[model samples]
Target: MSGQRDRGGYHRQRPPTPSSSAPNMSAADPSNVPDAASARSAVTDTSELVEARRAKLSAWRSQGIEPYGKRVEGLVGLAEARARFDAEVQAAYDEAVAAAKASSSSESVDDPRDRVRVAGRVMQHRDLGKLVFLSLRDHTGDLQATISKALVPADAFELAKRLDYGDIVVCEGPIGATRRGETCVWADRIELACKSLFPPPEKWHGLVDPEHRSRRRYLDLHVNPDSMRTFTARSRTISRIRRFMEDRGFLEVETPMMQPIAGGAAARPFTTHHNALDLELFMRVAPELYLKRLLVGGMPKVFEINRNFRNEGVDRSHNPEFTALEAYEAFGDSGTMMELTESLVHRLAVASAEDRRGEDRVRTGDEDGPILPFGDLDIDYRRPFDRITYEDLFERGAGFSCREIDRVRARAREIGIDEAKLDDWFVVNEVFEHDAEPCIDPARPTFVVDWPSAISPLTRAHADRPEIADRWDIFIGGMEVGPAYTELNDPDVQLERFEAQLRDGGDDEERTFRSLDRDFIDALRVGMPPAGGLGLGIDRLVMLLTDRASIRDVILFPLLRPASEAGVE
Candidate 1:
């Protein structure tokens, strides 16, 4: 098979099987063949293919050329090089060449085409005897390089002709368009950047297997344009969030990633030992506690975008490690946090809508509200996101009031939840999660406010209703995007709630990570202001905006099962 690589640096190849046939190699000495190849016929075909690439590596070494490349000066990216192509410059150069030819003089005419030096991995290569054409790709985009044997040095031309599909190359040339209307670089000089020892994937069917894509993401990034674009959008999305927050007088901050007690959230934490201190530590499940500590330290407004580690099961929406954004504002309550969240999400949605236009995706064409597509749903991000009370939704969904202990227990048991072991409010919350959450409109941004105080240990109790907390959870595209709280700042109340949570007999997994943070209670006792706090799932938010289905899709390098573990599948 001809190995013609392209910007999508892969070619199709089935893993060698026992029934596969190997092509005869005339240049390979029979005695020099690996004994394992003859011993195990199943690997013979793969061995032969590998041997061919290895031979090229040997030849390059014998010619005194390094297989790897060094930093080359004055080299531009492929996209930048392509951008330098100008129609007027090419026409002028063409006219000058024509005039020189007509005069029949030995004098050379000044070339008007823009000159650029560029480098990238060879995507496509064709050797047409005296001329060679190579397509190169960088992160920005791809460009074609046309190397003429008559124009370039003899040695450079020879190198171009023999270059393999995956080899990286640097070339200098005048930016011009081909006769067939393809923009290209007409190379006067070329150099080998690196010699690739492995064959690239098949050009027509590049790294298609999803499992293979995640495992070998390096290849996927080069081959899959969609993947590169997804990550680019993700980066821009994060930067926009940072800028948006900074412009609103919020100071970005960093918090300790490891803590003696995982006090932020109820999620299980990954544990580790600090050998020097002879003490144990857990990777922070959330930066909430520390961010609040900053508020206690006189920071009026603060936010952090960072990684949090949790011991959790993997799913389309969940990762063991994920990014979260936490913010705290002094003298603010749940209502204040709600307003901030609405403004931030709406702004991001508008930005994403503009980005969708750039990506050429279908738009709803409603300028009054920017609608972004998330899977099959077109989520509208108009002003005044729908807000409903937790009690109202639970009453409607469960067909009973949230305070109905008997009905809540019956519903929990019907859903196969063990109501006997858990507390009454816990059972009610379980029923609400199973029934009430699904009632939310997937096509609209919503906030479910006024959660039960018992379920929100860190939130302030409602002034009128002692059983309900002044809290709200934002949902979009059927996912809980984030939660906001009028934080509990009273030291005695906070301590009482912490003790109640510890005695709540949470599941074994939850109980393992649940513990009191004495220092955090001490911070509360130091007279912190009544404030609002928020924690958002940044990855999930990006997934909604970018139309990515899974958290893994937006994550650059998601945690994956080992190859050996995968082979068993």
Candidate 2:
């Protein structure tokens, strides 16, 4: 890799001429350099473009150059390389080059620009006879690389001209700006990193279809900059959440994703069979029960952020498999968990606001707090989120008290709910979900508390109001973020609730999955302390924070039907 300084302050590699021994290095081979028309036709005729790339791949190998390169050190990101460009240094070099040219001197100008090595997928390529310009994209962002026929080796220059839109390549050059003021890497050396054989998406309209984006996330990440930013934010947010919990004296823990009985929440579970034990196991619908077991085993404050699988329908806010954050604090009630949830959510919202609008632009105070947009609504995550009792909300929305079972049933039937098949409390909940939940302002985070004890089997009933469980669910942007419950630690009461739940199973499908966790009851008998438990939907939280419309957008790979079944080509 011997080099000389170019007029533009770039360390130029000595150009090599093709010898008789290297027949594949022939720069005159038309198949080796894809023309503009062939590149543009890739979207319409993928087979031709793929065949062309295959030919180039073979040509590189025949020239004793591996298309898939080995590890090289000191590789800088595209964004960082672009940032390293010094306008003053470039201006000085340009002036010196102009002076030498005007004097008819053969001496080369001293090139002092910062040198860098960068690698990324080729997103855009333009061949202009002696100069080839390429836009390369990495996860950080995109930067342009300029290759001059006089600077780099003949083989490297030929490789640059033949590069296809998804092919990854490494470039070593001085960090400088093009004549048009576009920041770029003035490459004197280029090497193929990975040869992409498949044709890429249309240049102007890349990977726009939602189904395709979700199915092929790798392509989506490369083409869609917003998707990359969203996923990066999601990763950072999860890490911040873990740190927040740890700072609050909570220990992060892991729980089993498979359970003998899906006893956490009332959701259908995906079942699997173990070959050695010859027993059926169910994917955990929630980590609630297992987390509670930790409380029994003397882990005073513990939390888990992991996947939960439910055999359920998928929609804007629902995914069959999703991430969740579940935590429990010993001797704390629903109020304590509510405070924790509110604080954690508020902190995340403030951080998100700072990221969106610069830190100086974020406003403060009670009334003017950090506001985040979710679809048509602007949600405020200020402290002291609105609170309302479930009964009060039901009364406000249905125009009657939920205690009036007959009126509740009538409202349920009026709203197209099958009141005849549901229990009294269940009928109340149906009306509440359909009519009451929407009464809360979409722009404000609200907690609907004191749900009926019958509906909250694992929650402790309030001492004063035996029928009202000490449970609260937080809703933001018209979506239920999570729920907190004062846990039921009494073995006798828990057993009774479990039995009642089994007796009240509405369908055979529900009955098949619903079972008593006798071991949990036994753990309770071992003298577990009263605790507050909360479960937050991580995917939905990300959707709200990132302002994404659907859960599928935030999820890297959401479940979908096969291509044939989905009617996709």
**What is the C-alpha local distance difference test score of each model?**
0.84, 0.86
Look at candidate 2 and tell me the lDDT of residue 421.
Answer: 74
Q: Give the alpha carbon lDDT tens digit for every residue of 1-569 in model 1.
A: 11122111121122335664544422244553333334444332354666777887787778776667689999888888888899988888888888889998789888878899999888899898998999988888899999998999887887899888888899998999888878999999888888876678887688788777787788888888778878888899899999989998999999999998887788889999999999889999999989888888999999999999988899989989999989999999989989988999988888878767744443533565578878888888887999999999998798899888998898898999989977777888999999999999998999999998878889999889998999999999999989999998999998988898787646777887678998988998887899999988999999998898999888988998755422121
lDDT of 2 by residue, 373-423 (tens): 778877877878899999999999989999999988888888899889777
Stretches of candidate 1 above 4 Å error? Answer: 1-47, 95-106, 362-369, 395-414, 420-424, 508-513, 565-569
Best of the candidates, TM-score: 2
- For each candidate, what TM-score against the reference? 0.87, 0.88
- Superposed by TM-score, candidate 2 places the C-alpha of residue 453 at a distance from the truth, in angstroms, of 1.3
RMSD of each: 6.3, 10.6
